[model samples]
Target: IHRQAHLVEGFSEPFRRAVEREIRRLGVEIWAGCQVKAFGPEHVWLSDGTELIAQTRLWAGGFQVPSWLSTCGLPTGPTGALLVDKYLRVQGSEHILAVGDCADFVWGSRLLPKIGVYAVRQGPIAAQNLLRLIRGQPLIPYRPQATVFVCVTVGNRVAVAEKGRLVWRGYSATVLKNFFDWLYMRKLKPLRWQEFFY
Candidate 1:
């Protein structure tokens, strides 16, 4: 059961369903929305008065912004996301730019998921805006796309791609996903091909 780092919110539902389906296929009893309250000698006590005994426990709840972000003095919102203007510049810094997961700009005030595609698209725009700013030229506004492709692994050697109204599955999707992953790695870490390929 390996859920990659980028799976969040809507992206998690399919992965969770896949896990549940696989577990059911194996004749394993699976429970949803069961919150564990305390750890016992060899089991877990649930808030709903249920006991689950297992030798291994897998925790995959997801991660949050690093703790040190607060000490860095960046203006963070309620969820600890760094606030940035449309130009992808930090609120108080004229020259400082923000990109990737660090920028908290959202469309229509909705929070954007911290995904690779968003970061990839933002880098060039942020760079462009920064260059224009340095040259005292007009800066371009950053506009995030509403829909993005997500290729998720469903165990085995299979994968699925989901976008606005598009869905594709199986080996072809897996191959495309692998290709896209490789492309991103090569682009982001061009000089370190050995490190990325490995």
Candidate 2:
């Protein structure tokens, strides 16, 4: 169930539509603008007043930022994530940087989405900026990707993928997803990013 009007808000229109279509095709019911209001031993109730039966259920509660951020004196947005400048530096603080889900980074007109892909991409830039700061060099600003590539696994060897205007579904997409996952995990080549801290 999703509280938003669309399954994946903030994403491109075509991508969101394709993802919803593909997942629905997998026999999964997509419930937008609703939430589980309550649950019982044999039934579950939704905010929309719909009752569902038969029982294994999963709840994916939203994120909550760290409590310490509130009293730390650094500025934070409504979500409690530390507000950051384009360079990812915490507002009103020097020599401190935040990235990933913990930061409220404004990219273009809106806040950058807090997701794994953005976090992974931010890591190197954060490290590089830190090193540059130590060396008394100018920090480089993070540049978000224009086109996003995403692959979602619906069920049983099937997946859906999106890259800008392109979309793919089924087993072939799953294979592509698996290959990318394996490539990211391959140990033969490490990014050697640890050196940035040293």
User: How do the residues 1-198 of candidate 2 rate in per-residue lDDT, one tens digit apiece?
Assistant: 787788776666776787788788878888889978989988988899999894788777766688998898889986789998877889887699999988988877877767667888888899998998899899999988987778777777778888778987888887877776656655446654333211
TM values, all candidates: 0.70, 0.82
- Worst 10-residue lDDT window for candidate 1 reads 1-10
Superposed model 1: Cα runs more than 4 Å off: 1-36, 47-49, 71-73, 188-198
Q: Cα RMSD to native, each candidate?
A: 4.9, 5.8
| lDDT of model 1 at position 108 | 82
Write model 1 residue lDDT over 17-121, tens digit each, in one string.
554454455565555555677775689777678887877877765546777766788787555767788888887878888877677776685767777788888
lDDT at 187, model 1 = 63
Candidate 2 clashing pairs, residues 3+ apart or interchain: none
Global local distance difference test of model 1: 0.69
